[model samples]
Target: MIKLENASYSFKKGFSLSNIDLTIDDGEFVFLIGPTGSGKTTMLRLIYMNILPDSGVVRVGKYSSNSIKKRKIPQLRRSIGMISQDYHLLADRNLFENVALPLHVIGYSKSDMGDLVIEMIEEVGLTGKENHLPDELSGGEQQRACLARALIKDPDIILADEPTGNLDPVTAFDLVKLLEKVNAEGTTVFMASHNYSLIKSRNHRIVEIHGGKLRS
Candidate 1:
């Protein structure tokens, strides 16, 4: 779960987020819809403690921005999954290696790492493409690989920023359906997207932010 209590963050004199109070509960799929430069990314960063709030509190699971230690950020991040528009796959690394990176970072056992990575890849429907590099896959397949990488750790929450941004309409819809399946499996999902039309028909909680403040 994630919660922000009157959280505020400022980048400069005029552009900043102010008094944001939001909550994302366990197993919920919440869509964050906003215009460009509306602070959606800032809000996601705050939830994951990538950046601290200027004031107020941000609570992601047990870690609180108000008091969490710097050294514990990695541990906090391990409990949360992150996906982005660009896929962020390592071009030189194949799907298996890319998705296994997180497990390697945490020093997971070799056998466990293999099992988890393969399971995640299959979950995201990239089972047969384990040895393929990023460029070898289509846009949707690449994004699916990104999703596998994010899910490999079995994180409690998934924060996706414009996850379907680069795909064609049909592919984007398929990707969202995969996200829905992930949510159905009990992982909480909070996705930020600028294209309202892409997500408008989904029966999920939609929160809008404008001018650095929550509009709904």
Candidate 2:
């Protein structure tokens, strides 16, 4: 489960997230809708513990923002997949290598890593492009590569922040469908986006945020 209790944070430039509370049960798919700079990314950052909250608590499963140790942060992150608008792929690495990077970080054996990377690539419809570099693939394909990398670890939850912001409408819809398929298989999904039309008809909980405050 993910929960925030009276959580608040502030940036030096004056933007702040006011006292906020939220809870997302396990195996749920939720949508976060807001305009640009409405604290969407900040919320995800807090959940993932990339930045600690200035007050109150943010909890993801067994980890809590108030007491989690620095050494344990990596372990917490390993169970949570993250996708963003930017592909964040290594410039010099091929798709297979890029997707395999996380497995390497966790010290997976060469044979096991190769099998996992290939399977994930195939899942994202990039099977034959394993040798292609990030720049060589289209934007949608790059995004799919990012998705593959995220899912290769079998995360308990996926935090996607405006994942479709860089693609065409058709491609964007396809990505959402892919996410939905992932959710159906029991991975929790919390996606933040400004495009209401893309998600309006979906049968999921929609949480809105504006000026750093949730409006659900």
Candidate 3:
């Protein structure tokens, strides 16, 4: 579960997130829509404990921004998956190595890591491109690779920040469909996007944020 109670944050430039309150139960897929600089990314960062609110509290599962220790932040992040517009893959790494990165951080055995990495790569339809570099993949394929990296750890919730912003419309739709498939498998999905057309036909909860304030 994720909850924000009267949470507010401020930036040095006068932009701020107001007293935001929200609740997302386990296994729910929620869409967050907003324009550029509308705090969509800020909200996700808060959920993952990248930054804490200056006032009030933000909670995810058993972790709370109010009292969580810095040392424990990494442990909290392990349970959450994150994807973004820019595919944050290492340029020097191959697809298999990139996908296996998280497993190494979490201390998985080499034998187990290879099977898990291959399984996730296949799940994202990148089965034959394990040796390829991120630069060699198309925009959509790169995004899928990012998705595979995010899912390899089997996180409880996925926080996608404009994941399809760089893709064509058709590719964008396909990516959302893939996310839907993942959600159906019982993982919660919280995606932030500005593409209304890509999501209007879908049946899911839509939460709108404008000027850092959520719309009722």
CA RMSD for every model?
1.1, 0.7, 0.6
Task: State model 1's lDDT.
Answer: 0.93
lDDT of 2: 0.95
Ranking by TM-score: 3, 2, 1
Question: Residues 52-143, candidate 3, lDDT per residue (tens digit)?
Answer: 99998999999999999999999998999999999899999999999999899899999989988999999999999999999999999999
Give per-model TM-scores: 0.97, 0.98, 0.99
For model 3 the local lDDT of residue 79 reads: 93
User: What's the TM for model 3?
Assistant: 0.99
How many steric overlaps does candidate 1 have? 0
Please, what is the whole-model Cα lDDT of each candidate in the order they appear?
0.93, 0.95, 0.94
lDDT tens readout by residue for model 2, 84-161: 999899989999999998898788988888888999999999989999999999999999999999999999999999
How does model 3 fare in lDDT?
Answer: 0.94
Writing each residue's lDDT as its tens digit, candidate 1 over 88-143 gives 99999999999999999888988878888888888888889999999999999999
- Candidate 2's displacement at residue 44, Å, is 0.3
List candidate 2 segments past 4 Å from native: none
Clashing pairs in 2: none
